[model samples]
Structures are given as structure tokens and as C-alpha cells.
Target: MRKPRDYDSELKALELKARQLKSRRQSQLGELVIATGADALTSEELAGALLAAVTTHDHAMKEAWRKRGAGFFSGGRPGAGDSAGREPGGAASGAGSTPPPSSEPGAA
Candidate 1:
């Protein structure tokens, strides 16, 4: 038979779990901001940079996800332009590294 969990211990464990989740969120956001430093990469270039930093996903899948994500943000709205062709600066963006000028119809 399994031992019943004590209420006090259970509450403590729940609190610990919450703390862990919060810590993870904080680190993730920090990492995200830090990843893009300087670069003129298109959206795809940015994602490629981030993807290079982590050994999480297969190359093909990562590219596919990046493509899908860019589409989600731009949608079919007009003036999407080069944004449609690029991704944000992931791990490669740095100071002075700006994306190319947008190529939308009327983005002057």
C-alpha cells in the first residue's frame, strides 16, 4: 500500500513546484532577450541563431516551426513585406545589426 501524503508536506511541495515554475519562466525570458545581441538576419536568420544555441529540435523541424511562427505573426495582412521573408534576431542579433529595410508595398 502507498503511504498517504501529509497535508503539510503536500502544501510545501506545491509551493516548491510553483517556485520552480516561476524561476523557469524568469530564466527563459532572460535567455530570450540575451540571445539576440546584434545581427541583420531575416526572421529565419534570427530563429536559426537561437536554434543553433539549443540542441533541442531536429534542423528540419526547427526551420518549419520558424516559418510557421512568422506566418502566424504576419498573417495575410498587407505590408508584411520582407518581414514575411525574415525572422527576429534570435541568438545572433547584436548591436548595429539591423534587419534589412522592409519591402512592403507602401512601407516608406
Candidate 2:
């Protein structure tokens, strides 16, 4: 009767107070952990959200890795396929075949 109703109100008040305290303490509270009454989101929603985050992070990481890789080759921007053009001494770039030692060494 009245006792049961009072207990319900007290429980509701305590739950609300705890939620308020938690919200005040956390910055990511803007994102909801659960709905008030609706069923939890489906696996599809969770997967899609996770994929979007991964794709964004992956793209950013790839751009950074590319920049670092380009820097490794040129110490600056790598030109239009210039990394494949030629070496400093113009030997078709890359670790080319090391030429054999000269045989006619001072005619000796």
C-alpha cells in the first residue's frame, strides 16, 4: 500500500541521484551506454559504428605512414615516381648488380 509506494519513490530518487553523479563525473557521458527502455541496439549497429571508427583511424594512420615512408626515401617529398627513376650515380636506381672488379689492374 502506501509503504510500497514510498519505497518505489525512494528507489527511483536513488537511481536518479546515482545517474546524475555518474554523468557529472564523466566526459563521455554525452554518449549513451543504454537506452531508457528500448531494446539494446543490434549487432549490426555496433558493427557499423566500430567499422566507421576503424576506417577513420586506419586512413589517418596510412596517411602518416606514407608521409614517413616518403621521407625515408627523399628526406622530403618523393617526386612523381622519382624514387624509381635513377640512383645518384645514374645506375637505374635500386640495389643494382654490383659490377665485377676490373681484371686489367694496371696491366697486372
Candidate 3:
């Protein structure tokens, strides 16, 4: 006759693996915060800033941010202009100055 499987041990191992993965994810997120220099902000301030960025609806603004983020992930330094064909702030201003305010209400 075949022996019974140790289901309890298997369940315990799976639970431990899940906990380890969750801890690693939290650690990685902390590293990202520090890398971005956002660790200087209070938790509330960081959360608010992230909320604002994520909730922005301007397509051009989102694209600009996307390119910057991609560059960061691709090991390109910030402000390196890797986002071909678009000069920094050139989309909104003639002299690469700050972009104009979005038409969206409550946008900064």
C-alpha cells in the first residue's frame, strides 16, 4: 500500500514561502523609495505625491512621465534626455521652460 502524503507539511511550506515573498516585496519598495530620494518625505507626503502623479489625466504629461520612468529603469540618468524627439518642457513652452498648467480642474 502507498503511504499517505504529508499535506500539513506542504501547506506550512507554502505559507512560509508566501510570507517570505511578501517581506521581499516590502523591502524592494523601501529600496525604491530611497533610490528616488522620496524617503525624505513623511509617509503622508509621499503618499499624496504618488496619488497626484497616478491620478493625473493629461496624456502628454503622462507620456513625458512614462519616458522618464523608462529611462530610469533602463539605467539612464535623470535629465539625460533619452526620450528622443521631445526636449525637456518643450511640449508646452517655446524655450524648454516649465509647461503650462493643465486644463483639468484641480491640476497643478
Alpha-carbon RMSD to native, per candidate: 14.3, 24.0, 12.3
Root-mean-square deviation of Cα positions for candidate 2 versus the true structure, in angstroms: 24.0
Backbone clash numbers for all candidates listed = 10, 0, 0
Lowest-lDDT window of 10 residues in candidate 1? 89-98
Runs with alpha carbons beyond 4 Å of true place in candidate 1: 1-4, 38-93, 96-108
Instruction: Give TM-scores for every candidate, taking all chains together and pairing residue i with residue i.
Output: 0.36, 0.22, 0.60
User: Mind sharing the TM-score for model 1?
Assistant: 0.36
Better of 1 and 2 by TM-score: 1
- The candidate 2 region of ten consecutive residues with least summed lDDT is 30-39
The superposed Cα distance between candidate 3 and the true structure at residue 50, in angstroms, equals: 2.0
Instruction: List model 3 lDDT by residue over 68-87, tens digit each.
Output: 77777778754223332465
- Superposed Cα RMSD, model 3: 12.3
The better-scoring model by lDDT among 1 and 3 is: 3
Sorted by lDDT (best first), the order is 3, 1, 2
| Per-residue lDDT of model 2, residues 38-83, tens digit only | 0133568656755765667577777875665567556453232344
Give the per-residue lDDT digits (tens) of candidate 1, residues 1-108.
Answer: 998869999899999999999999999766544333323446686677677758655888778867755764566422323333474532233223333333443466
